[model samples]
Target: MTTAPFEFFELHVLRATRISPGFARVTLGGAGLGRLASGGRDQRIKLFLPRPGQQEVAVPVGAGTEWWPAWQRMDADERAVMRTYTIREQRRAPDELDIDFALHGDTGPACSWALTARPGDPATVLGPVEEDNGGVDFRPPTDADSVLVCGDATALPAVAGILAALPPGMPARVWIDVEHAADRQELPTKADAEITWLCRDVPPGPGGPRGATVDGQPAGAKHPMLEAMRAAAVPGGAPYAWLAGEAGCVKALRRHLVNDRGVDRRRVTFTGYWRRGTSEDDLIRQAIAAAA
Candidate 1:
């Protein structure tokens, strides 16, 4: 049998702390966490949170790669609330992993769990066991002379990790959108990065700020993040762009970068963290349908 790159690991909530106005950092520790090898920049993971009143996550952990089908067969209400998140940092000295949750004061299960996750609380995580795994999205090509990273609050953990992993003094233009000025974080990077932080005075609705559309310009839309990107200039040489966060924004940004900005589509890596007014379950269904 071939070795699987990802596997389920039981994660215990060692502690939760308010790292910023918009983020809650949850430190998870468990016996097998040493096997969870994170590739650093934009390392993604499937986080399984127990529903209210449940003692632990309800996923079929022993099923390995077949766990998805097994999970869907379980009762929806009783099953674990699956959400995608980034690994902010992984330390093996004591086998601990830090995950940052962007709190929007919404009714989302992940947000609710993060707010009240207590020490010793149990959850499940499907994370990478290999360093060079598909879970990591940020991959700047060798020939790329500069980097452009854009995302909303949901992508902060990835942005921070990407900047930290950049070669020393490499040019990096980063734009991040947060709901409030207080949410701004000091991202330490050795990449000579010029980061622009945008704070939305009022977000339209739940998922995130309404961002650019397919045309790269939504008529009468007040997208500060897109406008900021348009106003700024990128490096002349080949540039690798990594964009994520709200589906609308990522779509719009990717369009602008490829169509308007003339960046090659192959050079851009884009992902939609979430769609406005859509649940992760719905997105999962759409993904499955599309794949079918």
Candidate 2:
């Protein structure tokens, strides 16, 4: 099987359907999809949005250092905006995949585009690349007795994916916080996983806005989802935890799980899927900076 550069992949929207009050499922089709690995639950892919009236977008083929010059040489109007999204579901036989977009108003490029996406629309698929460990490694070599997966609306697809892929009877717990009660959807999983949803009925909290409460208390004040997780007494033992969502919430959960609960750092995978008040590009930059 030959794998091409992420940028070489073409964009073809096969179908789009409303999955829920706040989510739209867009199915895309292309050749060689089966060859591309099915990114496990919570895995992300970058989408390159085409400019108006443009049929294709050029993607650099190699390292940033080798690709920057070519990227800079392109006209400003021809450049496509990049956004990250989760692989909600994938089917190989038909070479099709579905990505669920959270319809949280028109605040960003990808959200805005997805709001109006229709069949036959165009989009550039960027990555289904391997993780840092190389290839798919769902079972990490760790001694933890349980697993905790946490995230907000942005992380739901990943949470659902992880749940569906877990080995039958594996012990895990999932915590999800979304903008509203209607955002909750059925998760398919055979693992001994308990999922709790924390609904924030108010509009999304403004980025950088401190002291905003989800209900009558601060957003973190016994966040319903976290409280439920903490209260659950897994008789087996402490488990490795995976946390993702807005940068602040993820960071806070990491601190709570590690500093407060004394979870071993090696067993935890925490990611900031997005930031409250920053552009997707800025969020990526921030993540890179933090890792650096």
Candidate 3:
């Protein structure tokens, strides 16, 4: 079941559905699910997927502190594939976990598995057992007067979760980047938030889209997410910002908010979901190096 902060649960696929042009929703349910608790708002979990030709994912469950080292020592072709993802939603009564996968058309192992995952497909997830665990990252101070959120398709689930959890009527400025306009989905929020969806597929002619300018350059920049944030007028007086998505883009957004917009560095929460050009295998290699 649960061991204070984190624990492992043997899970299986209940269903997999393509909800958008670039997203897939996979529901998981199994034993010990009753002990799994989600901290909501950008809850993170490590999903263990089986390697090709394997029936079930192989991981050292309940290894606790030794989980990482033990996993590293396992045969690469036999061990489970580990990937980080945000909890889209968690339900009870029947006890089910929902995870949204950003489909990359087979580039990512998780994405590839999700595309063809069948009901009863075995998997494992290392998740939190308590409500106040450290996995949830969207933490806004009590004194924050406004909120700013920016992300691409990879961060959509976390962004949506943050918006949904925000206090009623809290002013929020949100910008979401997607590859296609059809990828936009309904994000329900009670906050006084202005949400902007930028589709890179749509060309922003000449001067820029909507006549906006980024750092004296055309507003319709190559990476519209960064350009839009740089040009937008944010509210003053104790604002907290949350940024995620591409590594370079998140870095630039954080820099813009802190150095250029005067937002306190401590108040901003930023995470890089992925790098622009790096493959998933590259990340695996990097993780192995770091662990070593």
Candidate 4:
């Protein structure tokens, strides 16, 4: 059976706040956002950002699969930038949702647009309608007794969402790496979680690069987060591991869990949220290659 097409909503920024030195929170509301009342953890949506000199935001409409190509066909100057973000919270009664964006320097289109976004700023988001739950990548087995979660700043919002979804008393452990001390935020969870914050001591590379790899190690081997992850002990139980972050580091961690640690391959879930020097599209291409 053919799945239903996703619905699109034109959102206005209700508010914007600097939650942390490296994070910004944008609250968006639209008439159609109430459809997300039952959204799941790590739910993702694509944001359509206005191109340079554009004042109004318009969302393309068609079958789920068709909208993308149709949007791509539009004149380059008329097209809005597309970027993926996780829904931090869904508030139905007020028809508002929260999205937490990781702030790097104003280098990329999405980052630049967000840096100066103000209340009443117009944008478009393609999200799930009432019929579907959209696409959420985090899936830990219910029968598992312990959960292992790890990521860098890019995956922090998703990690927070997953922790909120886990049941009380669930044994969970999290290791998050951040570029600055100000990047850490309180993550509330009912699960018995042992959280570790890994703050980097080295100077960061220029904010974006594609397929960046270190010599004699994995792609993101130069990142300190991977070393911390490598040294940590996996909690003993029927553990389900969910790892996300830089693509190269993710690959290395997955190898550690499945090959070095002997965790069941089927019980591990992983995603490469981004790469050190690549765009989201590049990450998608790498994911496809890995699957092949």
| Candidate-wise lDDT, in order | 0.84, 0.67, 0.85, 0.74
lDDT (tens digit, per residue) of candidate 4 on 1-292: 5654466788889988888778888889877777654355677788888887888764576546677556656775677877888878777677888888887553777777776789888888888775336477777776898899988888888888889988999988788776666778888999999887765533334672322222111124365555655666777678998888888888888888888888898998888777777887576456546755
Candidate 1 structure quality by residue, lDDT tens digits, 50-88: 888989789887777787778877887898889999998
The per-residue C-alpha lDDT of model 4 at residue 27 equals 88
Alpha-carbon TM-score of each model against the true structure? 0.90, 0.80, 0.92, 0.85
Candidates, ranked, lDDT: 3, 1, 4, 2
How many clashes show up per model? Answer: 0, 2, 0, 3
Q: Assess the local accuracy of residue 126 in candidate 4 as a C-alpha lDDT between 0 and 100.
A: 87
Q: How do these models rank on TM-score, best leading?
A: 3, 1, 4, 2
**Segments of candidate 1 deviating more than 4 angstroms:** 201-221, 287-292
Range of the 10 consecutive residues with the lowest summed lDDT in candidate 4? 210-219
- Candidate 3 lDDT, tens digit per residue, 157-213? 998899989999999989888766667888999999988887755555565654232
Q: List the residue pairs that clash in candidate 3.
A: none
**Candidate 1, poorest ten consecutive residues by summed lDDT:** 211-220
Q: Please give the TM-score that candidate 3 achieves against the real structure.
A: 0.92
Once model 3 is optimally superposed onto the true structure by TM-score, how far is the C-alpha of residue 223 displaced, in angstroms?
A: 2.2
